[model samples]
Target chain A: MTDDDLDLDLDLGPETPPVTPRARPTTREAPKSGVPSAKVMAERKPGVLSRVGSSVSGQLSHISRPNWSFRNFLIVLAVLVSLVVLAENWAAVRISFLGLRLELPKALAFLLNIILGGALTWFWLRRGVAAREE
Target chain B: MADPGGAWHRLLSLLQAISQRGLWATVPFALLVNSSITVLTLTIEPDGSAHRQISVVAAPYFRDQVPGWTRDVRADADWDMAWAVNREDDFVYNRDARIAALPESGEAAALTISDVAQNPFSLYTTYRWHEVVGYSYLYDSDPAAAEATNKSLIYEITMPGTVTNATVTPATGSSTKTEGPKVVFELAASQGQQTIEVEASRLRWGYLLVLAYLAAYVIYCSACTLRHWLRIQPRKI
Candidate 1:
């Protein structure tokens, strides 16, 4: 219970040094091939026109190689025939439709063609995805 | 899940499934519907002629001076009456009718009847009169040229039935004569107003059959597509 006993009880381990923060890396390591790092390239914004052009080109590339099938052929034939008939009897057909009459026959016909073609394309894509899964 | 873009994606996928299952059936339906509409809109025949009557007042010089005044009265039954007056005129004096822009004046005029359906035997009549300024040198020397040059009016009428008692006013030529389906009347030295009359018969039973068949086919194909689409199971996300 003397001073020596008190010092022995209080003693724990050897004094540890104060920890210092690690220094920030001064310069980024150069890319091995001399190309900009992915982080740096991604940080740069693309021009509006270039972005739009890339997206359009991507869609066109996707559409260029449609899977050929009987259903696709029939859909294409039906669309072509509808377009031809619309072209030949534009005046008569324009007047014939009740409430859906349009001023520009070619425009209306093209709109209809787009809707039909889009629907068919969607169907083809869905079927292809399903078949691949199976 | 409540986002608008998510909802749009779901709706699009649903449509995709429906269309994929029913595309085969829908193709024939589309073809039938388009063909039916084309046939109904363009080729359906009318019950009667458009019946356009046009009278051109003869100029003072042309009143009685033209010897063969009625020689150019051409009657074409096969010609489309709707486009009769719109056609190009063959004669120089009759060319005025062919111009659509110029106002109705001088030797030409036109009458149009809209919404009138086309017919197979619709009669188209054009009255053109040319002056007979004596006979040419070859015909001047021959007496037959004088007889031939004498003012003559010709009526060429076409109809299915036999043209019985067909006649023209101030008649001085041969009686009503039948040539196949046409009735021709030649009159000598005529002046003033003249009238020609004949009866026609038309066949009218095939159109209904065609329309009915088209309707039935469209309905059948549409029903099949609908049934197939309804039976399809919704795709799992």
Candidate 2:
């Protein structure tokens, strides 16, 4: 019933009449200021797709999605670059060491030098570990 | 909470790290234990027949006497580095006590099986893997070759013809060398023996016959084009 329709007068009332609350606060058990982080987490579950979607939507609010046809273009470009680099070093280079003639592609020679250096370093390190353990 | 397997896992991780970073440190005579792997060499014949020679430490690098894989299974002679193959599963030898410096020498063995049914010449490619009977991890069915991680598992395959492509699956620090028909794939034993897929083809009668048909077809097409170019339209039907 509306408050205006509840107008009544009692004739003989010994004690104080019943007192009714006019209005109650709608928010209960909640802090007076803002929502808590824990409550926000409890309200929803976070998934991988949801996180990605949220990130995308936040940044590209009005931008359109990228085309799908060029998805593998970067991989193809990387392969092409590798092939070009290999081709660039394909010219035969000669080196004379210890009265022996060694001829190989520039790439191969560099690779061999790197391998030899790595082997030497590994051997030295192994020796050091052995001695240290002993 | 304490886990029983955690200790074992930690020990294994330490050993693995040591093996990768430096020389082996489990045994006292780690340096004496030769850092050599069991080399398996397969010489594929022109007529689709194949032979594999597997050589282990202190074992005879089985001198292939017969064209069909004849071997002397004698471990008495100090095995020089060569291909040694033991086709049978019952092939087991006594481990040399001097190598490991252990009180008692355990048993050592090797077994190799090839899928010759998929002939390279017929299929244009073939897949083969070595099931080197392993130890150390005895509880598990040691189907793969179990050796020192620092050492290499070498597979030298002499194909029938020039090898077009040779790739090892599950690459773990693997390297391949292709010299004409011979393809040598060296992989870390830690990764286990990987399947070797080789694509090779020999110049045979079947290929020559197919090429002859292609050549005729090309010539006929070109000749027709030439006739049309000359405006010789007399022949109909």
lDDT of 2 by residue, B1-237 (tens): 666684565456344433432221111111112323445565655433334455443223322222111122222122222333454432222211111111111222111212233342352433232222111221132223334435565668776667777787566667889998899987554453244566665444443444455566568668778988889656567
Model 1 agreement with the true structure over A1-134: per-residue lDDT tens digits: 79998888668646677888964443566588987554434334689998999999998887767644447656755665565445433321222255443344444656688999999999999999999999
TM-scores, all candidates, are: 0.22, 0.28
The interface RMSD values of the models, given in order, are 9.7, 17.3
DockQ scores for all predicted structures: 0.01, 0.00
Highest TM-score model number: 2
Candidate 2 docking class: incorrect
Clashing pairs in 1: B67-B151
Each candidate's chain A: what TM-score?
A: 0.36, 0.39
| Candidate 1 residue spans exceeding 4 A from truth | A1-134, B1-150, B157-165, B170-175, B179-181, B205-208, B211-237
Best candidate (score: DockQ): 1
Please give, for residues B79-149, the per-residue lDDT of candidate 1 as tens digits: 11111112132211110111112111221211221121434333332211111111111111333432454
- On lDDT, the candidate that comes out on top is 2
Find the number of clashing residue pairs for candidate 1. Answer: 1
